[model samples]
Target: MNTLTTIERRAMQAISTDSGRMLIVAADQRNGMKAAIKDAPNGSDAISREELAEAKADLVRHLANHAPAILLDPEVALPAIVDDGVLSRGTALVVGLDASGFETVDGLKHTRFVPGVTPRTARELGGDAAKMLWYTRPDRQGLDSRVAGEIRDLVAECEAEGLLLIVELLTYQLEGESDEDYAAAFPQLVADGAALAVACGAKVLKLQYPGSAEGVSAVTAAAQGVPWAVLSAGVDHETFIEQIRVAMAGGAAGAMAGRSLWKDSLSISADTREQLLTERALPRLRELAAVVDAR
Candidate 1:
């Protein structure tokens, strides 16, 4: 039904459906993905890489370490976190673009971008899917046709290169912007890359956090005519679960998250949340998929 339902999609699904099981650690932090992984959840201990070895069931995490309490850091230190025996273990490590190239200077200080993890030199440091972030307000860098074309070409090239290029439609609407600016960018981003994403082997269309049902609804609507899976922006844990529920409720395809799961003091005492996904979220996703299928 959707495009590129290849061996990879099967692999993506074998990890399980995106109900509660599709929980990606929200590494896109305030400072960036690196800062986001500082503390995973509130009122709990951070979920460390060592603890992650203990996480059973389906989980999509950005590979990163954490402080004990009160912070989060999600910048992927190395691509091997996902490629080298990591995703093979069933954890979808959403690798980021090159960090060494993404940062810039601000006033007397420098601002570093904490994307999934920058594309590195290691050949084994490959990603399940490549993610690209376009800034709307602060940089407005996403608006350049040259940059846009480069991104578009990259997705296409990844597939041609036998890799998958999955782009994330992200934004933080600052500078007295209207909701229109937020809503306007997605279609164009998709229009610019849809064929390329599918042709290049991307499995899904990951969207930024839509602040309201209307914004998320727009995402779902835009995705309806396209052949890609859609998801809302990844926020906090409580909100992340709720957002997944609402997107499923709204008949969205699924979601891609970065900060909520890893940006906390995560001491998951029990698999209650994991059990909830199996018991509650998965069933609900099945229903949503059915609704979309019926259409």
Candidate 2:
């Protein structure tokens, strides 16, 4: 088993249940949030930066108290959410380092970092840890090596600053890739991505569902000793709960769910947002937490 440094251990504890499972609420989306808001029935109004921040704040206010940690982006949910005291003192904060969107190169996706949200800056922002979303395609030649090198550097930076680094790996289909081919490869793509991240020194992971119970078990084995949590990837709440159950049974630490939890609140009134979150999202999260705890 890989032994954690003191700071890594503490940060991990802060974001996990007392039983050591990571039951986190992820609100660290920018483009995804905009899309959710724009797609809402009442979402005809022009979206503003303030609206994004407010949406995140609403999520935190209603749901942060229920989870062990909340993953937030540096752009919208940092100073104001913390400064305004909307975030609960009990929940640990994880600042995201990935910028909005990605660059498509040679039919593969490449990720970018937020210029100002480095490990040191995340720490200064009162973050217990930092997260980066990396686009992975192990089947592509030379891509894995390049991305692995970046993960290593970021891991070292976080270690120097005494902050935990949770690497979130996302696999995308190549341009013109067939749906059947992509579906067939999705399980291995996720499994390979998790193994690459863990080998590159990532201490924690937020991974997409690998598509089956067998694939889930492959991820757990590939993780070695590093703890990994399943990301929601915009799936529906019921689908995500089952994913969590399968993942925990396969040795996953827990979940870091986002759109699956609060996607409905994006287009609603503040009153409705609070009401739905309190009524719908909260129960969904509790069910997820129970699944994690059952592990």
Candidate 3:
């Protein structure tokens, strides 16, 4: 495995506390957040940009105090949160480089980086690490090479800028596959994606739960000593917490989660939202933190 660069090392250190584990709160959803809010009571199907920004900032203000780091989007949340000092001292900032919109072409879905915010730009904006999400499937012809090239470019740019690169690996089914087939295929797909990300020079891996303890072990092993964390994927709080415990037991460093912790806040009034964050989200974050520390 390749050694981490000075900037990469610093980025990793920034995201991880003295415990050497990463517990991050991710609020980088742009389109997804808007969609969730549409379903919220008294919420409009047409969510304005300003509303989305406010919601994301609220998430940071309420949740950032509990985690060592947060993942944010450059286009929406970064400016307001940074200007307002929502992120607490000693909390690392990770910026998402991928743009909104997932395109389906020829039965395969693809996502790519947005224009303007490069790894170097993220570093300039005070981000310690740059993150992107990629969809991976071994059976999907030619997709891996395309995505791998993107990862390679991102890693190279981040290395030059001294920022760590965190890649979130996801898998989608081919045409005609059932949900059960997709679930069954996810474990090996995640393991393969982790190895690919590490080989492509990602410093950290943010991954979906591979569905079983054995799957978790395989992913960690394939990571080749690169730290890997589980993403919540909008599962319930209890389910995500159990996932953290099982993942940590199988050698994951910790978690980088969103939605699961705060999705319920979408429909509530501002005061009640804050109350829920304090009463519900903070306790859950603390619980996950304890799990990571115990590991």
Candidate of highest lDDT: 2
Model 1's C-alpha root-mean-square deviation from the true structure amounts to 8.5
Every model's TM-score: 0.54, 0.95, 0.93
lDDT of 2 by residue, 1-295 (tens): 4557998999999999988899889998887777776454555356678877887898998887789999998887788999998888899999999998888877777789998678999998899999998899978733357788999899999999999999999998888899999999999888888888877888888899997899998988888978899999899999999988898999899899999998876653677778888998899988888889997
Q: Show where candidate 3 strays beyond 4 Å.
A: 38-44, 141-144
In model 3, where is the ten-residue run with the lowest total lDDT? 36-45
Show where candidate 1 strays beyond 4 Å.
Answer: 5-11, 14-23, 26-76, 79-88, 98-123, 136-144, 174-203, 225-234, 266-295
lDDT of model 2 at residue 41? 58
Q: Write the per-residue lDDT of candidate 3 for residues 21-116, one digit (tens) a residue.
A: 888888898877776564545565567778778777777778776688989998888767887887787788999988887787777677878788
Q: Give the TM-score of candidate 3.
A: 0.93
Clash pairs detected, candidate 2: none
Worst-scoring 10-residue span by lDDT in model 1: 64-73
Tell me which of candidates 2 and 3 scores higher on TM-score: 2
The segments of candidate 2 whose C-alpha lies over 4 angstroms from its true place after superposition are 38-45, 141-144
State the lDDT of candidate 1 residue by residue for 99-198, as single tens digits.
Answer: 3334333311123335433333221454454455543232334334344555556555554544444455444444455779746654444433443333
Better of 1 and 3 by lDDT: 3
